[model samples]
Target: MNTQYTDSKIRRFTIFKRLLNYEHLSYQQLSEEYFVSRSSIANDISYIKKQFAKEDLSLTFDNSGTFFNGNEIQVQKLMKRVILQREEVMDIDNLLMNQIANVFHEAIEKREIDIPESHIENIVLSIYLIIFRSKQGYTIKLDGKNQLGRLFFEFDKYPIVYDLLKEVEKCGIYHFSTDEAQHLTYLIVGSGLRFFLKDEKIPFSFRDRIAILIQKVSEGLRVNLTQDNRLEEDLVVHLYQLFLRTDAQTTIVNPLISEIKQTYPSLFGVVWFALSDFCKPYQINLSDDEVGFVAIHFQAAVERLKKKNKILFVCPNGIGTSSYVSAKIRRILPDINSIETVSTSKLKSMDLSDVDFIISTVMISEQRKPVVTISPMVTSKDMKKIMNYYIDLIIYNEQKITEKFEFSYETRELIGKDIIFGNFSTKKDALDYLFKRQDFSDELLKEDFISSVWEREKLQSTYFDNGFAVPHGNPAFVEKTAISILILDKAIPWGNQMVDVIVLLLIREEDVEKVEPVMNLIMQGIEDKEWFISKMMEVRE
Candidate 1:
């Protein structure tokens, strides 16, 4: 399917600007405006109509008045995101749009809406786009169920919003609808940034609702989260913004929807169960996108609940800069149980058995457990390294999900002469070439082996990092226990990680316990990539 997004535009943001207007545009005008053919407009309309039925939307272009016969507010939300994204285009129109956005920016600065600085720019851009659409002879309509907040408007609040619009209107722009003003009001007020920018204390009414909501969720998930402060506060803030967007029918597309569902399936399920019947007053069923967005809060809360590892910093630099590093680590990684700073001389005398990991400003050629070499004043790349190492430790300690992920540190029966050297680019080519060289039992079909690997990769890239991926299939497809390792000619892209080493494990259901140790060794090999590559190259000869 060569579907350019369902809402694909012939000209950047132009297709939608015309289609979503309250006025109906003929094909000739649309083509002339967008600098495309009438035939192209027909094709674009056809493509959108194809998605309408499946997406639960409607488009009627007859005497009954040509308009997309669905939630116009939702369409308006769609337009806001589209127009805002056009900031990337270097054109006269985009320049003017950015200038209009500045008008809202000034208004927000004056009123102090209590939204985070990061989000105020986005809200400003949305309002600017709304004003632009209204000026273009479009009467923004309220055609959707007001599923967000029942309190539509108050005279006092709206007058301030009107003041915000006065600057754009002064330029002899078309008079926009009162409804458009109300929509912008909700957008500005309902942003999630409001909760964070104001105070640490959440309002009791919203807090009380969130407490009950958590209780309902706990009942659904069958987990007691009654007094979880982080979960409660985050959820309250999330729902506050979610309500405004819902009322405005603002369509927020979460890029991490699939990734979140895959990474935290259990949590995603718990959220869906909780919100399915919970948000009824809002009038519509909760969407997967909404559920996914909410799930991120729960996931963070879950991570916060993880047992914090004790990190000991061994910086040889004077205590002044060393202390700075310790403070930086604490601020960056709050999940750390505790941070202990020690001098090189102190480290020499003290026992390290109780330490989780070691961080040092200067490299100590000989020391204890995994040492992360970092600068006293940490850089972004250094932070990434610290985060990666910390997260690995966290995931490694979680042994409860054993059947899903089983690895062993003992190298006795796991890996040996199975490691093979290779020169390849793509994952499929690399796997295909490597697997073909392996001797499978009569009962094990070669195609099944390859297909199963693909399935696992799709679920989550088995790539660990530093040029290594452990791709494997379900044990049901394995007739015998074996291992085949491929060292790529160069690192090839595997999901987000590039991998030069492919550790293909063929452990049968019966051999998982014995074969599990290979996973830890493989991890260590990848972590100490330079050494591992040299050691393997010797064998390749």
Candidate 2:
């Protein structure tokens, strides 16, 4: 096993666990817990302390004990990065297995070794099973290769082969080889094998070589074999190349495509097309719904890849927010094709380079990214103004694409802070308050409050899932208006389901008509089950 990698993982895990358990734990205590010396513990602590300091956190030792007084959110973020890095090692391990398999196959095909086809098959199958079991954390017992009688039994047996196999089982990969053996075995266990072993089942066929490879490599690297058991530099390069090639050719069927298609056909189509293009080089075949899911995944991957200019948006679910956003960008900047509406989890992983501007009602940190935050209950006039500004920026800069556009301002202005909160037991009561607030102006109220909702609902219901509705009318329908919110004591039927919360939006017809920003905000806020529930439960006055 790679001792360096192993030690690093252990140190990280130790620090993380210690932080969670004791707000204050000394380096000495950590050393004792991990059975490491004081100096080593101190070194690790020093490194962590430096990282914390960069994020404006202080690590200090007091009379009581040593503790980290960094921002809790920052600490959590760091912890997540540490955990995800560990997960990435698993992926690397899987790649190593594929490299080994390709090596063996190529060797046999080139007649480099005089082994029978059956013998080769047996070797592959045995290695596959061993990797499968190891990934599942199960004990493996393999029959000796000598029993196959494929090669003459040597008078002096090399124990390194067996030792390497054991190490591979434990760590996912091992680099040791016997003097007698001319080549190395890069063993891997794939996701399929991991799944099977997780369920205590055995694979019936040997066709899932890719799965086996991934599982073995993941297990091996996770156990710290990669750094401890160093291979010849040439061999490592070859293995890496082979693994990349194999992974590029690997295909995974998306199980959720059918569900996505049935539920969201248009979204499925857009995703499917986008992913088809993205995975073209890798030769991965994604289903329509899977494409949509992959589109979201790609959005996340791109965000992580860019890692700057964080953007955030919130929008109501299934309310044409995503589509509108997509359309408005397409209309204003026809070449800006990479824009996507994603859930909050995906947003968390985003690279943020293309995210100079943000459009949302929710209160996300303005410190990390330049934002043009807005209310979910935005007026059409407000939406038009925001969209036009962005569009104009895109056009004036001659930036035909959203990615080319950068934020010139540090922050955009906040809109509609003058709105007050009010709650009503019934839709009528809410409408009454809205009408009364308009000074009993019937024409103005109908045009803004009543007509706009009727018009928007014709396109699609604002009712997302989980008993909520964002009702709004077109800005053109209003003379003058005030925004009103209603929280029904009981679920009132709206569109397809009973909605408990209704956000009545009023806007000017003269304003640029783009629902995309508002839609994006709504979707962003309610993407998560917990957050959505909390937002719904907000007390209305």
Candidate 3:
């Protein structure tokens, strides 16, 4: 091969692309084609290899020609990036999607299959991999002699499945068996975004289960999440695919697992508690990857339920840059309702009362409100500045919401050192232990206070965040107005939430006004959960 070349970087990349596309170009042919000597051609190839090395790509030269030696999947990903970003549609132009779209359109129009625009990529990738593997002669038994095979058998003959297989055969030399086509059908249907249209009806049992799951999580997190039908619809689609993947013993690669776990630990904990049992029936280990994906859905829903803010953009760099900065803000922070821009001269004169905060290109001389200063272009530094402020504001706002329920009550009557219990397991055991410690009037028993508390717990748990479960009955059922603190010896699983601290309320019928204040106290516990949990654990009898 040639070892010398001219200093042209673009020519090197062009040669590299040709090398990837064709393996028959010899050193002599390339040297003549590029009007360079044999040594210059080698130098160009060497330069190409250096560039490839930076991208984690490799090249080899042999008697035939230059060969791209890399993992096929990694190479495919690199090709997709180059074609989408660098070429900018001078190349493929989404031809793969268009091809598959043609096949899916008929089934979709006929209502034999429902496909969502959001999941077109998944469908395309599924078909691509199935065809690729089938060409390599990968086979699975089609007949339902086994339990798992029955799922395929039920759908193998469906008109939609047969049509897709026939269409796929047109693009390749390989033929798909009925069983393989059925597998593709399940993958497409289960993972498609049809749920967003809200026309698809899931099974009653599945719908009920998802509703209960969301409701319990909502109760656990102290938020109203029932109205978000999108969340329910997405989970149904996700869980259906999850079940199929589990049955096939396949694992998913979640790119955002680390980020999600770090950003939303409490929400991650809530999701784990909610879905751990749901995985038991399928007998599959609930993986962190799956949890991360589920957490993303919940995080989006929570963000939607948050209060939107109005912002002011201060850019001395002119309207064009200010508009670009505003677009970036809207992209990063969907919670922003409106943003009004101003020049440095108008900074002090601007009506700032309606704005929640200010993002400035230059530092404000006077600090009247919260201001985040970044360059006009908006970089990651700006992202952090905006994100940190919102996070702090979120904590502050949460505390403000709890403030209304906080009041000075000197009578820590039922919350003294004597009323706290140190050891308990099940809810039944915890209740029995509490009952043994006190002698109540017959009126409380006649109202079935204990039975009512037990029954209420069955319907929905009283467990909120910070390892505290607030359990109480109707004021009418109570004979005494008291607060009982039950600190467990260890955390016990309490209806999808673990509990190490139990605060029992036994308010008298007339003193029912105290519940809100007590709940505010629980919110305070959540503010410093570690400290609260430590205090509960160390409380001695």
How much lDDT does each candidate structure score? 0.63, 0.41, 0.61
149-199 in candidate 1: lDDT tens per residue?
454334353455577677667755435577777776677656644433353
lDDT of 1: 0.63
Model 2: how large is the Cα RMSD against the reference? 24.7
Those runs of model 3 whose alpha carbons end farther than 4 Å from true positions after fitting are 1-138, 142-158, 193-200, 248-251, 310-541
Clashing pairs in 1: 408-516, 408-517
For this target, which candidate reaches the highest TM-score against the unseen true structure?
1
- Which ranking of candidates, highest TM-score first? 1, 3, 2
Candidate 2 CA-lDDT value: 0.41
Cα-based lDDT at residue 20, candidate 3: 52
TM-score of 3: 0.42
> CA lDDT of 17 in candidate 2?
44
Going through the candidates in the order shown, the clash numbers are: 2, 48, 4
